[model samples]
Target chain A: MKPFDRLTTSACALPLASIDTDQLIPARFMKRSRADGYGQFLLHDMRFDETGAPRPDFPLNADAAKRAEVLVTRRNFGAGSSREAAVYALVDFGFRCVIAPSFGDIFASNAVNNGLLPAKVSEADAEEILGLIETTGAAVTVDLHDCLIRFGNRNYSFTIDPIWQTKLLNGWDDLDLTLSLSGDIGRFEQRDQAERPWARLPDRPD
Target chain B: MTATRQPQTLFDKVWDAHVVTRREDGAELLFIDRHLVHEGSFHAFNKLKEKRAKVRRPDLTIGVADHYVPTRTRALSEVAPDIAGMIRQLDDNCRANAIRMFGFDDPRQGIVHVIGPEQGLTLPGLTMVCGDSHTSTHGAFGALAFGIGASEVAHVLLTQTLWQKRPKRMRITVDGATAPGITAKDIALSIIARIGADGAQGHAIEYAGSAIRALTMEGRLTLCNLSIESGARCGMIAPDETTFAYVRGRPLAPAGDVLDGAIAAWRELTSDADAAFDRAVLLDGKDIAPTVTWGISPEDALPIGASVPDPAAMDDASRASHVREALDYMGLAPGQALDTIRIDRVFIGSCTNSRIEDLRAAASVLAGRTARVPGLVSPGSHLVKQQAEQEGLDRIFIAAGLDWVGPGCSMCVGMNGDLVPSGERCASTTNRNFKGRQGPGARTHLMSPAMVAAAAIAGHLTDVRPLLRSAS
Candidate 1:
């Protein structure tokens, strides 16, 4: 993994709570591979009109938010479903960081595993960033190492669970992490075979 | 980082305490206690057989089938042949391994998470493992539980010990009484909306507050089941009298004196009075309304009265892209009121909502009101089905012309034959209204069982509050 090449940033800030995975990639997009560029399909239904014309009342239609990498939302983001496509689509859409008051349990893991940072800041601080963007269209800066999200002279220290923090910082997936402990696992298996061969072995001849 | 008072978060305590060892760029092998198993893991059992391994504590393991079963048509035999095969495999595996099997035919048969608590198998101060992600549902009883992948399932099966990288703790407190007719499902959606979909990522959440504490055991489970959906590894509520009382007399709970000793210890599972959380959020339960997903995602929902969002309101291309796709797949016209949308079918079952109480709630609504649209009300388990029948709740569903069917996970994921045809919208009682969750191209709108019943009768999405009042 590139140590510092990939930095997590957010995408469109909906300023709402309980965004579920179904909204991210929709089960329809799950039909495709991760390489199929789900980014274009991200938030499709929310962005268009019935005839498929883009709706103008939505925030994503604004020029400033179009290319913004860091999405600062209100609170409790990604609150439904265990869909990985939501995270995949977010990452594919060029968002490396998601700043919110909260996140969904499974969606957070999916985001971290996929190299998308689901950053949580206090609601006040999040609103501050949103206010800045709203008033001046200024982007907030999130420093991963400092663990701080900075906006006009204000810095909100976002708390990250140490376990998840470790995962995001190291870019280790479950498979990678499990395989990293091969030595200890091998030792335990060896001892187990010696102590309880029957439990570790097939009853029938192999 | 700016210095601030460190809140003793649930995520911090659980994560820090559980960390056995940590290394840079590696997953930690945190110790697991009281590993739980269910029948969707027949694949894991087969893999264990391939390796000639057996479970460390066959007694510590509990298995049931939830995912592959049909819920709407108790025709466990024919609703879907694939489900039958899975059920057969689960039965065979449990018998061969000597692990306790909560088969569909068993009195204990139910959704794995529901059965775990109702059966007294979920005890506080214990770590539970299940192949189901919503296994976090055990967290409601104050147990540390989360879903594991197929490989981890095999590991837990063989060693009873499963590795975990601890998550930070988050304590989400919803204070005040929930408004009348607002179910825990509404509270959960409101929290997600407030926190954003990925707010609690990398944290184990402890739901604490008068509102949460006031919830029924089943309601707590409903909240916990969606913990992962909110980007948390697991979510839990501290066990209390409600927890103990709910667990008592179950086939799995300790009998009499044994139970007393356990209850004495269970009381200690509550979060310390002064205990702080690394993250905390206080919500007013009153502001929460009946939330419904408008687009493809759960987070894309509005408070039933809201409109199909117009992405042009967004300032960015990326955001616009997501909004557009969600509307496209959902078959919604931007600016249309969500409540006005019509529904074709109603499904009332899943690990999230298919419980005895959920059935009763839906049955109460269906009692004299016939469904305007086709609907299916599936109880979470066979026992629940029987109990509903015994109470004549089944008759209410039948009288309303709803298919009160079998004991399987029917339309929740449409793994079985119970599915909505493409482009058709359904009011589902299960979690996940993602496009195609009910079937390929089928639209699923999630709600409480009662709400699903109301929608079935109205033939559209309608607030269940009025229905609950009218039913009474």
Candidate 2:
């Protein structure tokens, strides 16, 4: 994971709400591991037709959206499925961050893990940003340090969990963070193991 | 007794109990009591291998081959190459990690969510995690269960602790008595319809009131299984006598005094009378009909008798356009009668509605009846199948001209070979109705098992109430 501070790039406005993970990266494409970059399979059902030709009218397939690094969408973006492949698809497709009124809790967590910022602004602010992006094909700037997005002449602030902000900015490994809390975790395990003998983990040879 | 209310919700009680430590960023390191694994967990295993890390608590974790395994009882080699590899990978990874795996041929093999509760692996007052979204289904046992991503899976594998931001608490009270044919799936769908997809976002919902309390364990599972569809991280029902009895004799459950102690502890897991909720909602359970999704969105659902919603009727321009797009993609016309819509296929399985009870509900309808269209009946687990067989549910299904397949997530996710062909319409018991969820250009009408069984026999989206009433 790479540290992300700020980025100014063209924004792709997908106004539809509840763009679920299944639509983001369908289950068919989940067969392969992450090595087989999911860029092509991103929104496969929506992006292309049965003939393998791209849906020309779809936002991502549009001429102007080709270079979009920031995805601005409506509420509840990535609303279904816990497939991290959804995040992989977005990142693999060169998106630095996704701006939405809200995001699926799991999808937002996966986004931060992959160094992809899921900036959440108000619904009205999101619509305004989408409108600005539509009126002017200008780039949208997202500053993680300030939690603010600038598009056209307007600037909109977003809220993210402070911890997620640190992770996105510093590219912190969640595993490492857990490892750092090993002392407390160990103690909890010791007490838990003693208290709930039935809940004790079964023995396994290392 | 004039006392200040020190109210705490069920989520707070369970979450606070499991907190290992709080991080600087306000995220807490919560201990995971039980971790369920499936074929989708292979990527996390690979990452663990890459990092050369040992699973910290292999005993707490259990793996099963479900997502990619065929529900047709076919040999592994005969399955799709990619899918076979995933199943094989799950077995190999579990073996390497010294974790117990319920493979395809194992009698205990089933959907991760199904097997967990049936085997008593999903206990009350436990903080459970799985790599699949439907892990929320285990919350029916009063466990603080939620799904985690592959990377989080690796983290949990390496350390039995997960860092999570505390979610807001919500209570969804379904009031009134449910109608005869109104299954848990209908109540869940009706709730999502009332509240848009994001209605529960960032909240851990506690389902309560008379209607929810009346549901069977299987029905509770069915309701919680669709929590993710409503954008809730997890949905839970506090453990009661019903929940206690269900967990009492399961194979993995505690016995005797240990069980007594567990029950006593679980009894305290309910929300306090004066508990403050971030959000509280109410819905009439009796009002829920044999609902079905007519559009790409699960929230775009209506009663079986209602016509497809016209985009022109939508007040919001953006929302109206979305309706138009879903109608176009679904090849459905506005104002079209939902029951008149023909379905090419019917699927009656998935974590949402594949339990023994679900099968029995469908079987009761399909008995002495024949399916007008191709229909597949995949049980949730081997136990469910065995129980169904013992009760002649399989005979009923076969007699009704439906295929009684093996246990696994079959057409629900379509990672396996089962899928509705392109440009085909299907009445599915699955939770998701997203575009192409069952297959490319496939239109899925999410419904309850009874409704699916009714549609399968009718060859269209029929109102199941009349059929159910007639059968009784």
Candidate 3:
């Protein structure tokens, strides 16, 4: 996973709310190997019509938005499904950060693990940022260290779990971070085994 | 001097018991009691291989091949090679890791969430994790269960633990009695409709109230399964006699004195009298009606008596536009009566509503009635299929003209061969009605199993109550 601290790049606005993971990368596209990039499949249905023609009206189809690394959208972005491929699609599509009023709990967790920042701002601030991006096709800056998002002259603070913030700032995968406390985990397991024997499973015969 | 303990919610009790360690940043290291994996875990297995990490506790980790397994037949040879590969990958990965897999050939094989509780892997006061979002279905057993991403799946496979910050607790209490024919699915859809999909965001919801207590274990599972749709981290119902009875004789559950002791402990898994919650919501069960989703999102639901909502009537511009977009994709016109809308086909199977009770409900509705449109009724698990067959439910479905196929997550997700065709609308007993969820360009109307059966008979979205009344 790439360590992400700050990124200043072109941003696109998808003003829609409840943009679910299915829309991010549909279930059918998930069957492919992750080694094959998912960038082309990101919002595939929304970006194209039934006959496979690109929808020119979609903001991401614009030449400037095509190169965008930041996405500004409404509340409840990445709302459905626990598919991590959604985050992979965003990262593979060159999005380094997603700014929204709120995100699905699993999606936000998946985002940070893949070095993609899920920045949460106030609903009004999200709307403002999305509008600015739509009107100006602006380049926005996301500073993880300070937890701030800068669009043009206006600056808005964003919220992320401090632990996630630490992970992204260091680009540490969860396993590495978790494995650091192996000793404590072992001790806890022993104590738990004694206290709650019912929770522990007996070994099955090989 | 010792201070008196503050009253705790059911979520706190379960979560606190599983906490192995706490970081200064407020994230707790949770010890997962059960780790359920499906075919989707292949990515995590690949990551594990890259890191040269073996599964920490293979005994606690269970695998089921469902997502990509064909429901038409048990033969993998008949399936599309790419789809068949997914099941084989899970089989090989589980074999390599020494994990117990209920593979496609296993009679117990089914949707992960459905089989977890059926096999007694899901228990009260335990912490369970899975790659699928509907893992919350196990919370009906009073467990702290939630879905994780593939990266988190790898982390759990490596360490048998997960890092997490505690989510706030919300209590949704439903009192009063639901009228006959109003099912748990109706209650769940009503809750999501009132809460607006993201209403329970950032919180773990504990469902309480007389109505909740009255629901059977299957009903509770169906209710909790849809919690993720409300943006909740997880949803749980305090374990009671219903939960204990359901878990009592299951194959994987504790037996004899151990079972007795386990039930005694589970009895204590409820919220205390004065427990405080971060948020509280109250809904009258009597107000709930047979509900269905007319638009893409689950929250775009209304009672059978209502009409499709007009986007122009919505006060919020963003919400209005979303409604407009959903209407366009669904091929629905605003102000159109929901029950009058016609459907091309029907599906009655998914992790959300394919248990035996759900099957029985659909069968009761379809008995002695021929379906006007074609449909399919796949049970939640192979065991459920066998049980339904024993009870003659399969015969009823077959007689009604709906295909009685093998068990898997069929039609609910089109990952397998079963798919609703493009431009054709389907009344389905699945969780999400998202665009292309069932298949590309397939319009799905989400409802209860019995409701789906009713629609299958009527060839349109109609109230199931009248048909259910006639059945009785």
Q: Return the TM-score for each candidate structure.
A: 0.72, 0.97, 0.98
Model number with the top DockQ: 3
Q: Candidate 3 - CAPRI tier?
A: medium
Q: Order of candidates by lDDT, top first?
A: 3, 2, 1
Ranking by TM-score: 3, 2, 1
Residue range B344-381, candidate 1, lDDT tens digits? 88888888888888888888888888899888877777
Q: Compose the digit string of candidate 2's lDDT tens values, residues A1-206.
A: 89989998899988787789999998888878888788988888788888889988889998777788999998889888999999999999988899999999999998998999999999899888888878887788899999999887788999998889998888888887678777888899999877766665434333
Candidate 1 regions exceeding 4 Å error are A1-206, B1-28, B72-81
**Shift in Å, residue B153, candidate 1:** 1.3
Q: Assess candidate 1 and give its lDDT.
A: 0.70
Q: What is the C-alpha lDDT of each candidate?
A: 0.70, 0.89, 0.91
Q: Which stretches of candidate 3 lie over 4 Å from their true place?
A: B1-3
Candidate 2's displacement at residue B430, Å, is 0.7
Question: Which candidate number has the best lDDT?
Answer: 3
lDDT of 3 by residue, B223-273 (tens): 999999999979999999899889888888888888888888899999999
Worst 10 residues of 2 chain B by lDDT: B1-10
What is the TM-score of candidate 1? Answer: 0.72
